[model samples]
Target: MRRSIFETEHEQLRDTAHDFFLKYAVPHRAEWEAQGHVGREIWRQAAEHGLLGLEIPEEYGGAGIHDYRFNAVVIEEAARTRSGVALTLQNEIVAPYLIGLGTEEQKQRWLPGMATGELLGAIAMSEPGAGSDLAGIRTSARRDGDGWVVNGSKTFISGGLLADVVIVVARTDPEAGHKGFSLLLVEDGMAGFERGKKLDKVGQRTSDTMELFFSDVRVPAGNLLGEQGRGFYSLMRNLPQERLGIAVAGLASAEHAYAVTAEYARTREAFGQPIASFQVNRHALSEMHTKLQVARTYLDQCILGVSSGELTAEDAAGAKWWITELEWEVVDRCMQMFGGYGYINEYEISQIWRDARIQRLYGGTTEIMKDLVGRKLGF
Candidate 1:
């Protein structure tokens, strides 16, 4: 099905983003995977290309475009190239919090570097004991005259190793439940702030994921984000957009997988004929094509709704889980079509298959998404 959500401007942007990734990211894939992270130069290049700060205001040296379609184009091109770097984590997930909630001074202090890719940002929310349950977090911050003392640890923090500043979610009032939580900005070189070793993961090998520790780190009161006790609400408000991003990537990856497999089936032979000509393989391709079309259509609608501010948390939950689950299924089936070659590391399908598995797990699990939707339905 043809997508009508993008205007000519978006298409033009897509071409530019595609070329950028092909020229810079494609050749470095092997090295990045080996190093466990993409080079910081790519981030700087992305900033120079106007791909890093779509949400930041023009005064802050960013493009100042608030539209999500432009973001979708970048993500689509990245997925097409199978770049495992986490541009979306910066632009799609963390930028909003900074843009939407940062004070003018905070914007002046951080937004410029973030836009220029000179300062990388990461959010510390999940801990070893808490994943989706924000209320279960045990990281605490206590008032200390002109500053706040923070002590806690976060695991599975994406971009943790490279982050120059981390927005840490911690409990400011231990007895106040969700209302006690707050967001504190902890910068690099702060006393007692440490980043753990990069984790070895089954997929997204080029994206850095690590553990972060804060031991009696003192953050100035100026570093608090939003209200002192409204951190949970802020997190809730931004989650819809984050999940939407994951959904967009899921659809894009599924489409890419299907396209690669379809071409493979066309050329690879069975019984001296193209395997795609066989009824079983043809049927599989047809099923994947249909699934891709349906997912794309729904994803496009979600993108439109999100861009216009009409998307709800429940709706985003539905999109995130359903589309990611479909992406996994589509990639797995495409891998199977490659027969023995799919199991080999050299094959692109193998990487796609490995990378697609995490979609259903991160940005909230499929089971958690369904639970959110169910609760919204008055279950």
Candidate 2:
């Protein structure tokens, strides 16, 4: 699809990003998957290539660009490569919590390193029992004189094993309902801030996911991300962008899967005739192509809505759930056309199929997204 949202500069950015992923990420897939995490060098290399910080201000060693299309381009490129690169989400999606809510002092202290890739950041919001229910988290941060002592654990956190700074969500006042929660920036080297074993997963193995433990870890009062008792509101404010990010990834992956399958159908033979000649295969391909085109239109509109500050949480939820579900569906059907070859790990289709599964589960489950949209409809 010829997207109208991007200009020549964005096109150049896409080309550059595609080249970078081809060079640094593609060749290292097997090694990273075996190790269960990507190398830290890739992070710094991304920063050096000007791919790490698109939203950070120039004063903070970033480009300071306000466009979300560029961010979408990055996500799309990551999906195209299927290398499970997630730094863009860390930088553009999660880091905004501090950018929007942190004090000037906090920005001055963290933004530069974050932009330069010297410090990797992660947000700790989900607990073992709390996947979609943000209010059900049991992590606690108790006031202790000038500092707050945090306790509890976060599971399935992106960059959990490697993050230099983790924005931890905890209940500061158990009785205050949602108002009791706060976000505390937990830095590395802090007492009782330990990481659990790296998790094994079915897909996106190059992306780090692990458990974080905070047992009486002391965080200064100044480390608070925003107003006391307003962390829930602050988090809700950024979710639209996160869901948009996921949509961007899903559509890109679907497109790649379709493109690959189309080529396979043309070359691979069945009964001495190219599979592309068969009516059934042709119809399936046409349907997938049509779905992708339609989904891309809605996704581009969502991107513009978000960039223009007009996107609602409900629209984002709709995009996240719908696009990701489509992504998995399209990829699975494409893989089926590949026959037994798709099941082998050596094939990119197999990897794409595995990687697409988590899109509906993470960020937000499809069921949770429906509930969110339902609530917006006054349900």
The estimated TM-scores of all candidates read: 0.99, 0.98
Error of 2 at 379 (Å): 1.9
Residue 78 lDDT in candidate 2:
82
lDDT at position 294, candidate 1: 82
* Predicted candidate 2 versus true structure: per-residue lDDT over 59-137, tens digit per residue: 8788888888888888889889876578665666656887789889999999888888888899998999998999999
Runs of candidate 1 with Cα error greater than 4 angstroms are none
Best by lDDT: 1
What's the TM for model 2? 0.98
lDDT for predicted candidate 2 compared with the true structure = 0.89
